[model samples]
Target: MVTVTAAVTEASSELIARARAGDDEAFQALTEPYRRELHVYCYRMLGSVQDAEDALQETMLAAWQGLAAFEQRASLRTWLYRIATNRCLNTRRTAARRPATQWSVPGVEPPEPTRLGEVAWLEPYPDSLLDEAADAPPGPEARYEQSESVSLAFVTALQLLPPRQVAVLVLRDVLGFPAREVAAMLDATVESVNSALKRARAALRRRPPRAQHEPAPPAGSAAEDAIVAKFVNAYESADLDALVALLTDDVFISMPPMPFEYEGLSAARDFCALFLGTGREYVLVPTRANGQPAFGLYLRADGVCRATSLLAITLAGNRVCALSRFDGSVLPRFGLPQSLPDGP
Candidate 1:
């Protein structure tokens, strides 16, 4: 194992040397391995897929330009993360993020919302991309599981945090980077990093706790399938009672890019009734987002089903704990079509 490891390291070093010498292919080879994970990190930081993509491109460009200065004191992965994190911080600070969209469905008046959500620019991360970065393991200091860290609820909570606290928390708790390494990455002292982490943790804890609910069923397990199947059936049939029965007592609902949010079972029920009570028929194309069950929602009218939105749910045991509705504009990111032919 030692010999194999040394040989792999030697090859990586050679790739780095070639990349530094301006070999574009070598540079691509060196950075490609970290690209998906870096993108995920950026998504966690920025909350928008488009913004994450932009940050990722900028990070790669900066890395390539600064390759000569990479002294290899840290693993290349950590170095990439440092670049990605800083790039995301810059974006969070300067970018004009997407604005909140209004409730504009034709002939449908949504019930009064429970409250306006703060994270209006949030977008779902496609699970397909996550498969490519599956092997990333958090360090010993990590406080969240990999799947939990990527959930819609967790990511939404992250967006509410200040950018520096988000960075510190993600590096120290989510990705499990050591305090010294995180401080080095952020060009700060370890003491400051620790302080930021403490504040971030406290802020996160102050947010509503999902820990009180039972754990979600394992991905793709029978338990999960049963819940998803019931959701599809209830939603398609417009059976409000059946759908409501599948929700936890405190089930939360929010539509991003649109500020509407509904919390608790009653509010969720009202929102669902308003949405489903419309005379139009519907269909759901299954997909996964942010490590949770998601579907491309389509409105069937005049024998054609047109995409309307994407819905991702957070399950606590057999019942859903939260539902996130994203704009239909994100369907392409998950390889879902904009429209589908009406089913028999």
Candidate 2:
């Protein structure tokens, strides 16, 4: 084991040397392995997938340009995370985020929302990309499971935190980086990092707890399939009663970029009723987002079917606890077609 470790270290040294010597291929080779995880890290810091991608690109560029400054005091993975985190912080500070969109569904009047959501720019992360990024287990100090850390609820809560607090919380609790390392990454003292983390944790605790619901079924398991199948049947058939039956008592609904939020079974049912009463036929295409079940909704009208919205649901055992809707602009991100052939 010692001999193998030494050989691996030597090879990594050679790669780093070549990378610093301006060999683009060597840089790519050295950085490619960290790409997916770094992207996930950036996504956690910045809710929008587009923003995460931009931050990731900037991180790579900066890392490559500053390769000579890498003193190797920390592991490559840690250094990459530091760069990604800083890039995300810069984005959070300077980027013009998407504003809240008005409710504009034709022929359907939306009920009074329980409250407007604060994170209007929130976007779903496709599960297809999560497999490899989440495969590696988090470090020993990680307080959140890899799956929980990526959920919509978690990501939304993170967005509500101050950018530095978010960084401190994620680095210390989610990724399990030591406080000293996080302090170094953020250019702050360890005492400040701990203080920020404490405040972040208290704020999160004040939010509604997801633990109240029963645990969701495993992905792709028969239990999950049954719940998804029922949802599709009820939703596509426009059976409001059946759909309501599948929701938890505290079911929550939010439409991002629109700021509308509905909580409780009654409010959720009312919202669903409004959409179903639109006198339009609908179709659902299965997809996954944030490690949960999602569908691309298509509206059939005038003998033509066009994509309408993307819906992602959070399940608690057999019932759905939350529903998040995003505008049709995100369909392409899931490889969903803009339109489908008109048929039964």
Candidate 3:
């Protein structure tokens, strides 16, 4: 529950001193509280789970090695962010040059998308990790809730901004850092930070609306439970009508790394044609992702259900507006088994 601005407790003051003096255990204790949030920040910047982990490790090592040069002036939290955010920026610059492929299933024919999504490289942030960091309630100045900041739409919009603008916006608005302090973090003038913030805010306004402002319906609400029931029935029964009933008119479906997107019911129906044509009964293992309801889909063949994709859905009035199907490689990241026992 530690936030960036919590008054440094007396005990931590001691740890900080020892950590500065090259005490490894003291440094570990000193930085441990901020790990999860930093991990999320890096993920926001880099759009990859594995890269975020690597960034976190590099940030910590840099923080520890550079601790001796620390000026006690800045909050330890802000200093850690200085290292973490820059680490993310550096990693992203390299990744942007050499992007990886978006994974698709072997047997399932991915429908041709109407158009490509802007943040086609985007990935979901696991809520389980967010639970681990459960940040102390941010102060009023913080514009977005911790959970909202990681919403699939919000994060995807972020991937579209310039790196410096992303840094400014996340720091100044999302994290509620003051302009002066954020400028210090970005090594820019206050005026420059303010200007970037203005542009970033406008750019985001033009992107998708922040639809998921609420924490996803608490883990087993009757409403969510019913929705899950309908989804399972549709997939297992291969009832196209049942499936179509659950989607919104402007439904959006995207698979990252693949970049193809299906929009509107007509296109979506074309996309789901694969599900119907595959002739494989789907088994959906209920799960969660990015503070939204999700399912790990397994395709059944020869009495075995193998993992195919991890699908996260965004709901509107009981209909789905967005359906993000990630490569099954992300299954383990959400703590879901890659494969399930067949015949439920």
Best by lDDT: 1
TM-score, cand. 1: 0.97
The superposed Cα distance between candidate 3 and the true structure at residue 16, in angstroms, equals 1.9
Instruction: Report the candidate with higher lDDT, 1 versus 3.
Output: 1
TM-score of each: 0.97, 0.97, 0.91
Error of 3 at 65 (Å): 0.3
- Give the C-alpha miss distance for residue 234 in model 1, angstroms: 0.8
Q: After superposition, how far is residue 144 of candidate 1 from its true place, in Å?
A: 0.8
Clashing residue pairs, backbone N/CA/C < 3 A, model 2:
none
TM-score of 2: 0.97
Q: Tens digits of per-residue lDDT for model 2 on 1-344?
A: 99999998889899999999889999998888888888888889999899899999999999999999999999888898899999999988888878888997777788999999999888999987887663346678889987799999999999999899999988889889999999989999999999999999999999866548899999999999999999999998999999999999989999998999999999998899998867767899999999899999999888778999999999999999999999889999899999998885
Evaluate residue 110 in candidate 3 and report its C-alpha lDDT on the 0 to 100 scale. 66
Off by over 4 Å in 2: 208-211
Worst 10 residues of 3 by lDDT: 209-218
lDDT of 1 at 138: 85
